[model samples]
Target: MERKWTFLTSHLTSLNASTRPLNGQTAIVTGASRGIGAAIAVGLARAGAHVVVNYRQNAEMAESVAAICRRHDVRVLTVQADVSNAADVSRLVETTSAHFGAPSILVNNAGVAHTGLLLDMTEEEWDSIMTANLKAPFLCTKAVLPHMIARQYGRIINLSSIWGLAGGSCEVAYSASKGGVIALTKALAKEMGLSGITVNAVAPGAIQTDMLGHLSDEDLAMLAEETPVGRLGTAEDVANAVQFLALPSSSFVTGQVLSPNGGYIT
Candidate 1:
């Protein structure tokens, strides 16, 4: 399904609304030290949900994000965990619960993208992408399902990529991992639907992020020319889509991949 976006001009005015759906809830955002993940963590906090910013490295950046959330008067914590490691994921969830409460909102935004021709890629390269982009979501999702099932409400949003749908010219492994994420989202949504847990994927197209560092100026220009929106997407652009999917208003939506591609593909 197409992702719906509600654009707000400024943060100050947006937070003035009387009703906040996630005011008392807690959200855990993986890989939230920078880029899209950090944007999402801060957005959730602004909506009044306590936030756990999970990072594998970059403790300083994670703490900075947590501090931003604290300034919003929302509780924030930083946990170091590699989502691809089952043991670390378990500890991550436990720490989140102990600090705030069982997090009903989970943003599976942690991922790695490798650039190379499929023929030139090594097995280790393939494994690394799969573990972080696919297995990590599985491990983290499993860690949180029980609490969500007990409470009978939860939102699981995985960050996918337009590359997963259209396939990139030289990024076979990255594309495959995100494709698995889309499949996982669909299957798990059905499994968790009866329990009031909604699972969805957000596929972003050509977003301006550090991961796009490999793209030359010409490549970016070509992408901008290709997108109907006439510009490359920003981290905040993807974060807004995530905020919508995490809301109670999206309860009826699940088993869906919402592509925020700016008409790059239809």
Candidate 2:
């Protein structure tokens, strides 16, 4: 008998119109043209938040994600900006504010990964990874923080990796960057808690995204076997965690690191 497979997007229906938790809010999801970022944008829109889909280079892909968000009957805006650049981040934030309003939710989902021996990695390569994975979050948070603080409300979610918790063998730089994200999430959570803003990080295990394109079929199978859930994670799995963190009821849950790794490292 053929086994049926469950997808991440399939869980969206579980949160219907009656349960729209983010009504009247605006959310910004960086690197949202594809994969985990796109899924989060859709999830937030489904929860009734106007979504700003921020992408670096792919306008067409961003438009596609925006179309999906529009289906949820929430406002959708697509902005092209490199999250790591301060000026670009400023423009992205200002555009969101002007078009929608101060974004109450920010998802720092833009990141880059490098796989190689630490010794073989060049300074430029390491910097690129750090800038995208670590610095981008810092820049985006700084841009949106003032508004959140002024309003005494906000939710910020950073995308971390399982490697950040348990360092990977060949992905030293990526691991370091994500670990920094986790630390930033915790420290910022403490700092922002008094202002009614919550900060959290979602660390996803191996997921079916372009990030895994470098892996072979055998490698993927081996990873699945290592996971207790008997399968790789999905973008939607991570998105669900992000949605929970973005909800107003979760205001009390701050500075937490939620990993959707399917028990891969716990």
Candidate 3:
């Protein structure tokens, strides 16, 4: 017997609705100027959450994303801060708090990707990726935990990578940092459990974003063909995972790695 499946892209539904499940909540997304971060920001907005779009630079792009989110009628604010720095992170949280009360959801999606030999990588480069990918989540999570604990409810979804699950060649630093994210999610999930906060990680695999710009068409085709889904995943695909984690309905699913990798690594 042969079985086949069809995915209807055109049939996808919008995340926005006045009565959507996230109504009255607020979400903060880092690295949201473009790429997966942008998609997640809008998706959270569509679900009726007042959103904070956080970007280090690229104000123009961040504002553009904010404009789109505004169409959903949710309160949207664009904040510029380098998530890897502690002082900047504090200010970012404070600014969000001033405008939206307190963030109920935090998406730690700001990260850089590196590819090179471990020996060839400079110490600065290694530290840069680690700070952005791993430490920022630590700081962001720590900053938001107090309020979430006080309210006894929070959703923290960290953006990890499939490379974190299966190491990548020529991407040693990136892989190591994402793996640390997984560790952070697990440990924090345990720590925040009784406090009514859930910490989880979303590891997208070979998503079709600017991150794949370095790949040639042929290379991308090969990568897509290698996946069981026969295609590269979209930024929206990853956002779907984040959305699920952000929902109040997902309260029981904590300390988990939800990888939307098209079954490439599985």
RMSD, each candidate, Å? 7.0, 8.2, 8.2
Each model's backbone clash number: 0, 0, 1
lDDT per residue (tens digit) for residues 49-166 in model 2: 9999999999999999999999989999999999999999999999999999999999999998889999999999999999999999999999999999999999999999999999
lDDT of 3 at 29: 98
* Model 1 score (lDDT): 0.91
Error of 3 at 15 (Å): 14
In the range 18-137, model 1's lDDT, one tens digit per residue, is 346578889999999999999999889888889999999899999998998888888899999999999999999999999888989999999998888999988888888899999999
- Over all chains combined, what TM-score does candidate 1 have? 0.92
Candidate 1 worst ten-residue window by lDDT: 1-10
Better of 1 and 2 by TM-score: 2
Q: What is the lDDT of residue 241 in candidate 2?
A: 97
TM-score of each: 0.92, 0.93, 0.93
The global C-alpha lDDT for each of the candidates, from Candidate 1 onward, is: 0.91, 0.94, 0.93
Per-residue lDDT value at 50 in model 3: 94
**Deviation from native of the Cα of residue 89 in model 3, angstroms:** 0.7
Name model 2 segments beyond 4 Å from true: 1-18
In candidate 1, which residue ranges exceed 4 Å CA deviation? 1-19
lDDT of 2: 0.94
